[model samples]
Target: MTLYQLHAKQRLPISKQEAWDFLSDPKNLKVITPDHMGFHILSGADRNMYQGQIIQYIVKPFPMVSTKWVTEITHVKDGGYFVDEQRFGPYALWHHKHFIKEIPGGVEMEDIVDYKLPMGFLGDLVHPFMVKKQLQKIFKYREAKLIELFGKMEKEENYLVLRKI
Candidate 1:
């Protein structure tokens, strides 16, 4: 199995609380996600993200085939940060951490996702390039939609953190 990481950071022209509130809401995901992927929240919105919570969704990876993903909220720290992990899905592993911090005039939002593709060695032969392309398209659309929806700041730029220890 091989792991690939993707990190995206954006500075919003709003308070930390505002940023936290938006990201914390599961329903807001559809608004920020790319339309092509067909992302939707299947459950876990009623209680509003407590530990032991599970969020389910059907992601259309291709035209006819759909992957059902069930993610468990492993960690939560009130309004500061949260982590979601894939319990049952196509990927071998998926850990996504969402962090928000209050900066001078706005909030700094960071998303760190470490995921592994399936099929041990054969996975690399077919899925790596396609998966990377799909993710890039999704995240790129998200960045543009965020700026349009949240009203951007000067620091609304994403970065790649090659190493995190």
Candidate 2:
């Protein structure tokens, strides 16, 4: 069982509270996610996030196969950070952390995901060619959509920066 990690950070032209409000809402996930992935939240998300919140969704991670995913929000800090873990999903283990902090111009949002596949050796073998690439593409799409929605400020070396005017 090999664990893979992915980290992504983005600077948004908004306050920490605003960033938390958006990301903490499970429904907003479809907005940032690519449409082809068929991201949809099956849980009631009309209220603010709290620990023990369980969210379900159906996603087509593969070409034609639809996979049901269930995740639980385990930890949440009002305007700072939150953690979500997979209760039942494609991955054998899925733990994601979202962090938001007030920066000079706006807010810095960071995502950290640690996941492991079900099939041990086979999963590791296919990860590089398929799983990893797919995740990268998904995250890239999300980054582009966010830039489009919030407007880009300056293109730094690695992270996308959005400044408030």
Candidate number of the best lDDT: 2
Off by over 4 Å in 1: 160-165
Q: Candidate 2 at residue 8, lDDT?
A: 83
TM agreement with the true structure for every prediction: 0.90, 0.91
**Candidate number with greatest TM-score:** 2
Q: Which pairs of residues clash in candidate 2, taking residues 3 or more apart in a chain or in different chains?
A: none
Q: Which stretches of candidate 2 lie over 4 Å from their true place?
A: 155-165
RMSD to the true structure for each prediction, in A, is 2.2, 5.3
**Alpha-carbon lDDT of model 1:** 0.80
lDDT tens digits, residue span 1-165, model 1: 667888888777888878778888877878987777788778887666677889899888766768899999899888899999999998898899999988887888888999887987786665546777777777778778878988878755555442222
